[model samples]
Target: MRVVLDAMGGDNAPQVPVRGAVQAAKELGVEVILTGKRELIEDELSKYSYSGNLIKVVDAPESISMDEQPSKALKKKNSSVHVGMSLIKNKEADAFVSAGNTGAVMAISVFSLGRLKGVERPAISTVLPNLKGHTFLLDVGANVDCKPHHLLQFAVMGEAYAKYVLGDENPRIGLLNIGEEETKGNELTKEAYKLLKKASEKGLNFVGNAEGRDIYSGDFDVIVCDGFVGNVALKLSESLAKILAKILKEEIENHFISRLGAITLKPAIKSFKKRIDYAEWGGAPLLGVKAPVIISHGSSNAKAIKNAIKVACQFAESNLNSYIEKNIEKYG
Candidate 1:
């Protein structure tokens, strides 16, 4: 399978993404096409010794900045993101991965790859690492203002993604709300709960309402919400993890005894970091699209990009779009 990488979009740009493409080409045994300025990409490739010959570069002169609006930026045909999406549209690549602006990625995917049959709107689904395992959350900053039906679609798409990616045959789903009671949320959540309840009767494992406090406890395998609330939850969790890590480091370095103990417990701390690290999870997939599109962190390193490539490969091989199309009637 051929996976396209946006080499000029993220913070580290050509260097980190190039290294990642090389690693993924060697380790995953898949072809990687890097899209960016040819000279910059070639220069970075020179820094690494790659065993496989599966890596290639596609030159893109223009690049969309993080601040540019998706609608306006898409008009630039020469942009790196545009070039990458064109490759998918032309069947030159199996999937497209970018660490660029999230809005642009969503907009470009919809415009170029188009939405799948029976899908009204495409939503972004992210994997949240928890104590028991990972909880899949959808509409995470994709559509801020969603109708009740949009949320129902999010649940349907999220369930399909969690089941296929997480290897769960019957993943339990929950609606994010203020309380566990059925009549506890705003109009949106209340209407969404009813739709999900009806969906449960038709084969989906709907576990009812899930509050914010229950998210990290693995109360459900998939949590469904509008983009507004989902974005808040995702950002808050990420920020809290970083703050907690910093505080722990400060405490460990405060005294000689504590420093010694920290050294002894370094391995345990590293393990803890890995568990909460967003990089370890790779990227978020844009579900309900005809083709695979992954949006990685803007500050992603080589390892994160490599993992994202692996994720794209898995999604392509799974034939998830066909599965979702076959099961869409059950969700409605």
Candidate 2:
């Protein structure tokens, strides 16, 4: 499988992404096409001794900045983000991974790759590591404003993703709301709940409403919400994890005895850190699209990029698009 990487997309840029591509190429045994300035990619590659020539560089002079509007940036034919998406559109690459501007990635993908047969709006599905496994949260920031139908579609697409990625036969899905009762929430949530309930009769594993507090409890495998709420919840959860980690580290270093204890508990702490790191999953998959596209964090590092490629590869191999299309009626 050929996985395309946007070399100049993230904060670390060519170095981290290039290193990741090389590592993925060697370990995952997948061909990686790095899209960026050819000279920079080669320079980075020369710094490390790699096993195979599975990692190739594609020259792309232009790049889309985080602040650039998606529509305006897509006009730049030579932009790295555009070039990378084009690879998927042209069938030259199985999937596209980028840590660049989220808007640019989404805009270019929707324009070039197009949406699935019955998808009204393509949503970004984020995987949150939980005790049971990972919870798939949809509309994580793709569309700020959404209709009830849009949310219902997100639920359907999210369910497909959870089943394929999380390996759940019938993943339990929840609608994010203020209260768990079907009668609670605004008009949108109320309508969405009803739609989901109707859908559950057919095939969807819809479990009533899921409040914000219950998200991290691993109560459900997938949580569906509008972009407005999903984005806020995602950011808050990420921030909370970071703050808690920092507090724990500071407390551990407060005393010499604690420091010694920290050393003894280092392995366990590291494991906990890995579990809470959002980067471990690499990036969020932009579902409901015709092809696989991953939007990585702007601050992603080498390991994150590598994992993002794995995510793309897995999605492509799972034939999720066909699954979503086949089950579109259940969601509609």
Compared with the true structure, all predictions reach lDDT values of 0.87, 0.88
TM-score of each: 0.97, 0.96
lDDT tens readout by residue for model 1, 38-118: 999999998888856799889899878887899988787887888988988998999989988889888988988889998
Give, for candidate 1, the lowest lDDT window spanning 10 residues. 323-332
Estimate the overall C-alpha local distance difference test score of candidate 2: 0.88
1-332, model 2: which lDDT tens digit per residue? 99999998988888889888988988899899999889988898999889587988889998788889988888988988778878888889999999999988898989888899999999988989888677888888998888998888988898888888768788889999999788999989999888989988987889889989768778988899989889999999989888988998898788788888777787997898888777789899999888889999989988899999998999999978898988886558
Best by TM-score: 1
| Model 1 Cα RMSD, 1 decimal | 1.3
